[model samples]
Target: MEDWKKLYENPPETGVLFYNETVMDHFRRPRNVGEIPDADGVALVGDPRCGDHIKLYIKVKDDRITELRYKVFGCAAAIATTSILSELAIGRRIEEALEITDDEVIKAAGGIPSGKAHCSLLGVVGLHYAISDYLRKKGEATSGDKR
Candidate 1:
């Protein structure tokens, strides 16, 4: 509760005009909400208790992620986190995309509400899992595989 309270007291910048606008705009108009029919890989995760579910799709070429998309179902925080993550992953090298962390996503969203901080982790986990799926399909064990 303390962390959530702190967020309420000092909301972070969400790259929007209004502080809350960041979360609202993202949730309302989430990016990459559909599927890519030819996606190389896909990852899905869900928190049944919170009813937070996210699916990420990625397309890779020459060890770089050329495309990324997502379909997320959850609270405002989770949806916004997914939106930001998809945008960041596109056109990134696979390794670079894998390096993206929950902290980075949260910070980019002007800091999610303290109560919703965990939602950011959901997005990170989804991304990692999605990348793992892509790597596995490409016959690699982990993102660290140099070959």
Candidate 2:
């Protein structure tokens, strides 16, 4: 845990990531923070270096992502990113959902620290993994790969 006071103290040298209200709110009360019962697809990803883990679940209908849910075990950045990723992906075509970018998520979250920017990949990669799982189960090809 970071020292709250140290975080607030204006560091004349090194910069700090003062989490915006939006990020804090999302982290505190993340959206779609659970599993989908009988999920059509699921993925679990972890950044071994950061010890951050995310488990993503989804339900697809007619080639669209009708539902998305997730559980994150990591920093506030991880939680916030995944929370907003769910909002961005739900009700979109699987292809479109996979297109959700780190920039878009960061914008939706009102910007995260540049240092933690990589955390955004967790959500995007999670979606990719879960969607790929769905495609494989459906006996479909993903990214032009025959399987």
lDDT of 2 by residue, 20-124 (tens): 898999999999899998998999999998999999999999999988999999999999999999999999998899789988999999888888888888999
| Deviation of model 2 at 122, angstroms | 0.5
Query: Per-residue lDDT for 72 in model 2?
Result: 95
TM values, all candidates? 0.79, 0.84
Which predicted model would earn the best lDDT?
2
lDDT of 1 by residue, 69-116 (tens): 888878888989889888888888988988999889977787666767
Each model's total of backbone clashes: 1, 0
Reference-based lDDT, residue 76, model 1: 85
